[model samples]
Target: MSNKSSLNLEAINDFIVNWLKSYAENAKVKGFVVGISGGIDSALTSTLCAQTGFPTLCVEMPIHQAESHVNRANEHIDQLKARFSNVFNERVDLTPVFEMFKNQVSTSDNEAVLNLTLANTRARLRMTTLYYLGGLHGFLVVGTGNKIEDFGVGFYTKYGDGGVDISPIADLMKSEVRQLAAYLQVPDSILKAKPTDGLFGDDRSDEDQLGASYDELEWAMLEVEKGKKPEDFEGRKAEVLKIYKRLNSSNQHKMQAIPVCLLPDKLKLL
Candidate 1:
């Protein structure tokens, strides 16, 4: 990381906004669909999309028992629409879907994997709506993972919050995102709010799930990104190893090439 006081933020924002617009044009999408949660990541993503001048459709997909989150989501959607030319809010209640899954699965709250699965289900449901409506509106889904979350440990729901066509900010660290947000003049409230994904209730934050701050994670991720050996980060060695194992094991497919079974019938190749 460079000196915090002398970062070139304007160039970062310009690069992201330009790349976003070019990605939309190349993909033949009319716009981009972003799930705005009134949080910094979504707000920054929405602002970048709007800066591109292409249509950005914001959706609020709330499951049951999340009134507070629903209200916050609506607030951001309204604000986003006011400044953007083609911003609209679409609602798709996922209570029934969640209920169906809960009834069918034998999940216990004491089990971490079970709890994670439930949260991931919600993420996937929201992603499904975004992609569906994206197809209908001739747009693509915009993801909100930063570099720390996108790489290193992959702190995202595999194939769930991962339905993105073009990632404009995946290479950015959280600190870098803050700088870019400042350059874009994003609201102070969003910039200062604690980071969260709103997967369960308004109270659920990413820090709570990770047991550490984004800044701490960013250091470890940056080390890994720079090709540091797993054993080198002494104090963070075990912690980073745990995260690397989970992400690599769980998202094996995301990192691997598509498999094609080799057989006698398919042996002939040019």
Candidate 2:
């Protein structure tokens, strides 16, 4: 998010690889299981996992995913497999599973909420598939979300993309991720590809839904973090602030831990 590019890709890669290896050893897990969506975040995350010398299960769980998205996903996996001996690629199409789910849910009057529910179902189904694979193979589910998506706007689904044993690049901003992906030699096509969750049939990009570019959001998020008010943006204050507030407020729930009621000794008597 900072205009200053201070990220040391080599160091980041080394740190992530070491973390994965140590995590696997300490957690007694066999390897890392990653859900690849052909996006830069997943590609970078999977690459880091593969570099750890542990068997990395790179899965493409496509549920009504776009053809371009599918192609890019395969290309990235092929590249990773070609270079990293520990990289194992798997493609699990969940279209049938999603269709079955749609059939089961009762029709609702609110079409908008229904569509959103179905989209969230797609993400949760993918989460289920990742955990199933991890459970069967004794691997840890590695998530692909970057800082901007995971924290800035809470762009990920809870118990869905948000479900994972580890997150390697959750601290890196979207811009920083692109820089790291380029350094990792992620395929040029993938490195230059538009960022999308590939969850909807309409094939909308993240920027499209967010109504602001990652650069803009990143700047605004940083400003918010610095305790700067919307008025600080000067001429574009109102416009940028609107985008910032809408995104931060709408997705705040995803960024937080599940709520639980705590009881003290006296309250426990109830």
Candidate 3:
């Protein structure tokens, strides 16, 4: 991982913008559709897509969302549309749809499981909505996941936020995402706001859920990448390393391709 100060922000920005343009051209898609969560990642992704001179749709799907989250999302979208002629936004209030979904599903006695399942349902609903809009407009569903969440800890909902046609920032660490976002002139509110999935409809943050800050997680991820073991650290460093390893191991199913049981060619012929 490169230090934020050392990253070539200009080069990175140009590369991503060109990559997005080329990919969209190759796929024969008109543009991109991104889900905006009032977070830094989405803000940056939409900005990059807009820089490609393609139509960038920023969709806000709120399902019993926090006022702060909704406000920030709107703030970013307004700023984006002001800056780029190609940027457009849509707000889809999914609270009623979510309530209807709960009405149709079985309830669980376990509070933790029920809460997690519902939170994930919120994400999947947003995913489906993005795809729906994309299908209508011949656009690709842009993903907002950064490298750490997409691969390191896999802290995203599988097939929810994880579902997308492309991920623009999946190679950048969270710190790097913030740095690049800053360079791209993303709203300061989003850059400074604590990171969250906004799935729980509460004020809980990504750190509150992950048990470690992104900076700490990034360090742990780099150490593990360099073949360092938990035994090589002490105190908080060791604890963070353990947390990173646990998440990375458990979320392998989300990070890897779906498993396939291969049978012999002869069996297939029979």
Highest TM-score model number = 3
TM of each candidate vs. truth? 0.83, 0.95, 0.98
For model 1, residues 1-270, the per-residue Cα lDDT tens digits are: 231446677777788889988887887778988877667777788888888888888877777645555565676677777777677777777788888978987867687777677888888888888899998998889998887777655777777877677677888878878888777766766777778777765477788877666776666555665776556656665575456556546766764567997778557754
- Backbone clash pairs in model 3 (N, Cα, C under 3 Å; residues 3+ apart or in different chains), count: 0
Q: Pick out the ten consecutive residues of candidate 3 with the lowest summed lDDT.
A: 1-10
Q: Looking at candidate 2, what is the lDDT of residue 133?
A: 96
Q: Write the per-residue lDDT of candidate 3 for residues 131-234, one digit (tens) a residue.
A: 99999999999999999999999999998999999999999999989889999999899999999999988899999999999999999998999999899988
Instruction: Name model 1 segments beyond 4 Å from true.
Output: 1-5, 65-68, 104-110, 225-253, 258-270
Ten contiguous residues minimizing lDDT sum, candidate 1: 1-10
Give the top-scoring candidate (lDDT): 3
Model 3, residue 206: displacement in angstroms? 0.4
Global lDDT scores for all candidate models: 0.74, 0.88, 0.94
- Candidate scoring better on lDDT of 1 and 3: 3
